[model samples]
Target: MAAPLDLDQLQTFIAIADTGSFTRAADEVFRTQSAVSMQMRRLEERVGKQLFEKEGRTNRLTEDGERLLAYARRMMRLNREALSALDDNRLEGSIRIGTPDDYADRFLPEIMARFSRSNPRVELSVLCEPTVNLVELIRRGQLDIAIVTHDDEKSPSEVVRREPLLWVTSANHMVHEEQVLPLAVGRPTCLWRQATLDALDRVEREHRILFTSWSATVIIASVLAGLAVAVLPECALRPGMRVLTESEGFPPLPDGRIGILRGHSSQPEIVEALARHIAESLDNISLPAPEDTASFDFAAMNLAVRGRRHKPGQMAGW
Candidate 1:
């Protein structure tokens, strides 16, 4: 029989995957670089697969590595659950948290579920609003914690996740080819809205805001209906959408940086636990592989869009 995988080794492997470098993984795992390499060697040998390959200056996961990453993360999560379940110093308190719906849709389910399972008696109050509003609430001590779009130069916080922010259009739409591009975007104060407008201006593109809202659902609905193009972080992407590339005359936008902001109202222990859960949940979310325009079924999506006469428009917030 194959040797059972070591949790320690699996952890090191996960660190390497998360950090994308042996050196950084070593620091994260509190092991020497050589020790980290040795752990991986044994792990690869036990799994009977080469888990990593060199890509340029950094190491990239091989196909087998990616496959193992999913299982490894699950194992680690289960281990955490087991420990939490057995802990005697159980925490109990109501905590209020906030995040923009853009992230709330993709992130909150796992976070809330896991945290609740671990701390059954703790009450959770969740509010979904724009990051701008969420930040104000955090400052006013109206929320215990908040997840916000991290702007390092502006409102810096503990960044928990990062992904590409892409310009996107309906997979089967010709709206992207319009001389005057129509956009479905966030309200004026939204960082993503500013980024998209700035990028368009830098390229000297003529664009008009056809729809504006704080809710990601509304922006996505407009894109799906083929009414306008929009920009979204990778996690917020949905089917029937295609990423626009620089080759397609769409300028690159800034990275989407998600951060955690803690307020003074909640107990430190409660707030910290939720913050940790948020970071872990975001870490486990699998990013879709690089944009592939050919991957979406154009005809099917086009027919689906044409079959619908109207789509729900954006809401002011959340």
Candidate 2:
């Protein structure tokens, strides 16, 4: 009978195969490159075959190594089965959750960590995106649940959190004669962009997108550096940003809403649990402020929108 293989050596071998570079594999396995090399040597000797072929600066696994790679992954997964079986309800299955970038960075880590502590078997995949992308992802069944900004005009979705949108600018900006306001905008899918543009058109506020991006961090950085003004959830703003347009008359924008979207017929129980978790973590969701809503020229607006849609060339503005 053959001798039993060392399980630790299998781990090192798998790491090297996965990374395809000795240095990276060593870092991944938390061993010196030399030590990893030694482990591979031992593994090759036991198998009585070369496991890798060296190319210019890189290593490629041989046929034997490739055969071993699949086995290694299977073994590691099986090794975790004992721990998974004993996991709590919250961590028993795969729970794929999605939320906006700031929400993920700020509140989600703590929530997920706590959830996993009791339910260690549960695997979590989180997606961080702007509201538009998040909503689209949900409709496409790409996510089990998503937290998105509320659509104030329609109560068509389940809500998790709500707050006012604030007009913010870079803290370092100095006022000139005309108060040049550059705007940082999310891409075409954002409702905020439409609201901002409509408000500018109605009140005759002149502004253009100084930068357009889908990343919340990039948008915030640009605003903080005095590149442009932006509208965002009040909770997102900290001390360094300045409120540029703090009027009682600023048009009411969509509420800062987190929607709980579900992928149909898939892990509904886990999805419900995740939604409950978000609502609990974020507090009660609600509509935009009643008093802040700007008086709209509803008659004129409806005509313009319908006209633009039905008869493009005839709308007054067009």
Candidate 3:
């Protein structure tokens, strides 16, 4: 009889593919780099095919690996659902969740739907707020968990995904060619807003804030009306919006790290379960490709912008 594929190995394989580095995958799975490599070798032998190929410094999935990814994801999701359904301890507690409106619209609905189906008895209380406020709420124990965007890479949270920031405008808008670049931005506390200002400053670009709002809808509407360009996560770009690349003379913006921040107190089992579901759901998100541009030195940008702060009205004319 042949040996069946191991679930742990499958999970490790998926982690490597998601993170794009064996070292990062090892960190994710709580295994040493050598152990991750050995598991990958074992998985390849079990499947009788090479699952990955080296592309520069990163590992690219092979044809067989690409085919297996869908199956692996489905299998893992089903396995988790079965475990939750069969467990005798029915979860019954309310979980307070917070996230920025932009992310809440794009990702939370699906995550909540899956969690609701699995743990029908648990009640979910959700709030849409800025990431800065969400982090503070989590610290104050007002929220059980929060999905937030962090500018710091060393944040002590579970990083679900990282996406490059892009300067976006409406498809028919030619605002990028204006002498004084107009920006429709979020509140001053927004990481995207800070990164956008820093990037523009690095290139000595003259810009002015034409509109400010915490609502993604309002910001997008301003862009669509040709009022201004906005900085946003690549995943948040909609169909009618076009990303501005280096060719358009826009400087590169920093990548945004989406992560889960849990409250300090011991969480209820239901909250933990929901957090796990949220992480898995975010890992499965497929963001569109960012604008094609030459790579900018993120390390230098970080160093240069360190300690620089912008107030609400400070960005009048620059």
Candidate 4:
């Protein structure tokens, strides 16, 4: 007879795959590293195949391991759903959320307000961080949910939305008949920054970066004054600023998408509700919509960036 599979061991295997480190996996399941490894070893034994491989001391799920990882994810998700269905009266705790700077400034409050009104008993704490930082926070359990832009190369995990990344320059920028505009943008670590550069590189476009700033407003204002062109989400644009659609050799930026990422937990009700609430909020947000002659409201709450203490339009003391 085949040995019985401990669902818990499967979870351990999946967690290690998800986190890429036994230490992080252990933290996710509240076990020691040694304990997590033991569970993974037992799981591999039961399945009769090697589940993970190492690269110079770094762990990665093997091909067979990856297939099992998907199964484990599904099984865990279903099991969590079953438990949630059986525990309808057990959701009374707080859930912490995170978002990006632009999103926090533009769209998070309303989402939180809606979640609060509908589930008054469940306290929600919201924080904002960059996409890179937010993912780390989520994996560390510092946040229960977040709205961020994590495109293909940037995302080794699940994504919630795939929003477009656009180039914005000062309305007054000096447009030469044959010169690439000087650019102002956030730091190199930003997904927007990377995507913008990648797009430019892929197209063999020639442009000089003039400056980098953490503040979207600064970038926009600089561009507004014609200091440089910056790539930003269209939602970040206020009235009167225009995006350049006819750059000489540059096609519209491609492939960067806004998305959400999460994993299964014993606390599933809050996750699902919050996820729905976020999606609904995103659905209702009024972005400048896409248009041939006009920009449409493209605001989708779940697809936007947000942060803690975000005041709809700007961060205080920013």
User: Which candidate number maximizes lDDT?
Assistant: 1
Q: For model 4, what is the alpha-carbon lDDT of residue 262?
A: 63
Which runs in model 2 stand beyond 4 Å of their true positions?
Answer: 1-91, 152-155, 175-179, 245-254, 284-318
lDDT by residue for model 3 over 125-184, one digit each (tens)? 999988778877887889998888854542356666666667787776678788999999
**Full candidate order by TM-score, most accurate first:** 1, 3, 4, 2
Candidate 1 lDDT, 186-288, residue by residue in tens: 9998888999999999999999999999989999999989999998876776877877777789887777778888999748899998888887777666544
Task: Give the alpha-carbon lDDT of every model.
Answer: 0.81, 0.63, 0.76, 0.64
Listed in order, each prediction's TM-score against the native is 0.80, 0.56, 0.76, 0.57
Residues 1-318, model 2: lDDT tens digits: 999778789988877765779899889889999999899899899989899999887788888877776677556544544454465533457867777786666567656754564356668898787766666777777887776666645324576555556666655564211345577878876776767787767877666678888778877888777677777765466545655442423455544555566667367876765665555445422222434323322232232222111111111000
lDDT, residue 225, candidate 3: 81
Find the 10 residues in a row with the least total lDDT in model 4: 309-318
* Candidate 2 global lDDT: 0.63
Worst 10 residues of 1 by lDDT: 307-316
Model 4 bad stretches (over 4 Å):
1-91, 153-158, 175-180, 202-204, 247-249, 263-266, 288-318
Tens-digit lDDT track for model 4 on 1-318?
A: 877678899878866765778999899899999999889888888898998888766687788986786577557655654665456574677887777777777777777776665566688777767777877787877777777775456545444344455665444335422276577777777867767777778877777888787666677677667677777764577553555553335456653445555644456788778776665455336565545313322242223333211111111101
Q: Clash pairs of candidate 3?
A: none
